[model samples]
Target: MTTATPAPTPAPAAAAETGVPAARRVPVARAYRFELVKLVAQWRIRLLVLACWIVPALFVIGVEQQSTLPSDTLFGRWMHATGWAGPLVVLGFAGTWALPLLTSVVAGDVFAAEDRLGTWRHLLVAVRSPRRIFAAKALAGLTVILLLVAGLACSGAAGGLVAVGGRPLVGLDGHVLAPGDAAGKVALAWVCVLAPTLALAAIGLLGSVTLGRSPTGLLLPALVALAMQLAQLLPLPVAVRLALPGYAFTAWNGLFTSPEQYGPLLIGVAVGLAWAVTATALAYLLFLRRDFTNPAHDGPGRRAVVLGVLPLAGLLAVTAAVLSPATGATGSGIEQAKVERSVATAFAHLYRMQTRQLNRPDVSEARLRATAACDKGSIRVPVRGPGNDWHCVVSWHLPGTDATGTAVYQLDITSDGRFVADGDGPKEVNGYFLVRTPTGDAPNPLWQFDGDVELLSHSKG
Candidate 1:
């Protein structure tokens, strides 16, 4: 009876001060702070931050340093609009490799670390609820992701600004852009790109729940990223890319131009969110039903695989559609359509000749092929080709002043006479002028257009 005195009636774990209402449930703020501390203290997270900043910064310097400004090099064509600095580098490299891996490193391990530390019991005991604990981890991961995104973006911009001059950016679609416009659009692209990737952070959460540890969950988002990129390359229906979270990876490039193309951007985000929400929910549900008494993930199992595969399959088609070179978008007006059929034929012989004809210096043409009209005041040369023909308008200007005038020759020619308008717009074709200058010799690559400009790059035809 004396021993059953309940050990002197031990007091409850309550507020330090009795009147403080039992400390009002430990204020979720404390838990949040605790979570932040845990995340910041993570070596994996610090390394990831380093990767985001250092790697992309180096990439920016590497490409910008090597590439010639206004370079028509393939890499230049694709990335020059954003320049070769950190922003472009991050945009080019981060989306391809760094971000995905960084995301995986932390996200995949978010929960696994707890299991590894045997802290599941401790965390559960303190948080008291699985859902709240998951929320804290998810929030922590997102905070980390955003911070990384910001870091990468800042480093890229700084690198580009410092090394390469802030020049007008060329877009993926081969359009020149203003500096301010380019910056704003690039920022928007970054936002669009990140929106879908947030799901990746959520993916880590789901992985953590399933693996009961962080490291075990990494494979899901990595596969998702790789799969999404492949999907964009496949020639499929738009629904494919639209349904995948990784679709945003390529759509970021579209933001560097006018009439921003976010078809893929929106799709990627929707699919990613769908995956993030559903998978994370399932992860928690699994936790609720699972018995973690002996927490162990089979290193690399097929279980969390569906988490990566399902959304990837759905979005692949969407990405393919988003990236499929749109014939209409590039070369498909009624005029362009008509031109597409025969524009090549008209230029074919010259293209084959592979000759680099000197620039002609004649503007306003006063002569015509006998078919000249007086009242019409026109000279339109009928350049005929196999089944297709084009009328090269010949309005005259002084011969010597021609090359220096508003007349733009929209063509890319080799050292030989072979030339192609770099695809769908007007390229000035300097021929024997009505008032030709024999001394006309500067090889100017400049070209202009009336109405809309469409060029046929040497590769296209």
Candidate 2:
């Protein structure tokens, strides 16, 4: 037998002769490419991308034709004031519902679809490593989400610019921004939304892996976003709200203010990163430990659950430790000095606008010399903190007038440092809700103005 042994036809040669290709290991990059190809090939994903690019444009056109604006949304009242407002108003709506649902549609189904089609075993055999497969799929989902967001932003901006024309934007602080400056800030605001959206996608990935069902995965992130929205309506502490997943949606409000605030945006990014890392890690561990042989068993085993939960708890502790110092007492309480400064600044700019509308000489903010004294309830009560009972007496000097003009404003402040100031003034000045301008009847800036104090600033009033 030894003499006759035809040096056993080599395995490679035998397989080649049999017309069967050898099973070769796929590198991570190759696996990633495959995932992207699969995702792009799906009709639904193609439609989603197309819709993302087209829907916002239609929305802008629709808004342009409408008489009444969506005043309840931030930047909505300014839709006709500047082209940039159109995109911002759309952003406000997308952040609450569209973003989470859109992202979940892909991220939640990426992994679960393989399980649903009974292709997990085949995928595992080809990739040879669950870790690589998970990494590839997760990266693919994230890439798609980023693309969708970019499409929405660009389309919205383009539509607004074309339909309404570029114009000076009225900022949240009542200051006017040049067309170029407003364009840049609007783009940056859209960029800021990416963090929380990615975090939501990661959560969707976790749901997809744990539940092994596309429908559940699709709904989980949306449900979580809704829960966060509801929680925001509660009287939770400012720090807690800042840490929430939904807060990033409104954090862009600070960017439009004069002396732009970056604290909320920074905290939002950190919180999002923490959530993304935690969710991805849990999903990866669960995917790695899952028993593919048993098609009926979908849930993770006890040991896998322990391994996943421990890291989540540890990461949460670490996040809290890192955020505590940065937030400090700033979020714990709203300082009276900060509120006074914000109100005074807003009033000065708005008063200038009022003067212009009345066909008077334009009043410069510096020349206005506006000052505000605010108190919560009676003088005995401290003026600091958030409340509807706060009242402010604002005094300003017009350039040529010897007599100082004083306006009494009733304030309602929220825990997050935003406030609405309703002026109690004679009808001829600050009391009118609308003012007749050359263009049309517009909102009276001094009647009921909105402003936000900078919680992170160290400057004393």
- Go through the candidates in order and give each one's C-alpha lDDT: 0.51, 0.81
Query: How many backbone clashes can be found in candidate 2?
Result: 0
Show how many residue pairs clash in every candidate, following the order shown: 49, 0
TM-score of each: 0.63, 0.88
Highest lDDT among the candidates is held by which one? 2
Winner by TM-score? 2
Stretches of candidate 1 off by over 4 Å are: 1-25, 67-86, 213-216, 292-461
Residue 337 of candidate 2: its Cα lDDT?
Answer: 84
Candidate 1 lDDT for residue 77? 34
lDDT of 2 by residue, 195-238 (tens): 88988898888888887854766688898889878876666555
Decoy 1 TM-score against native? 0.63
Residue 352: error of model 2 in Å? 1.8
Candidate 1 lDDT over residue span 1-461, tens digit each:
35553433223453333443331233465676778789889787887787777766666666666644323322233233345324754665677776777778767777777777777777776777666776677777778888889888877776677666567764433345677887787687678768667777666666666655444467767776776667555533444434566656655654543445455456566666766676667666666655545545333345545644465444445444644453222211113232332222323222211122443332221221111111111235322111112233222233334342222123332111112333322333333221222465332222211111122111232
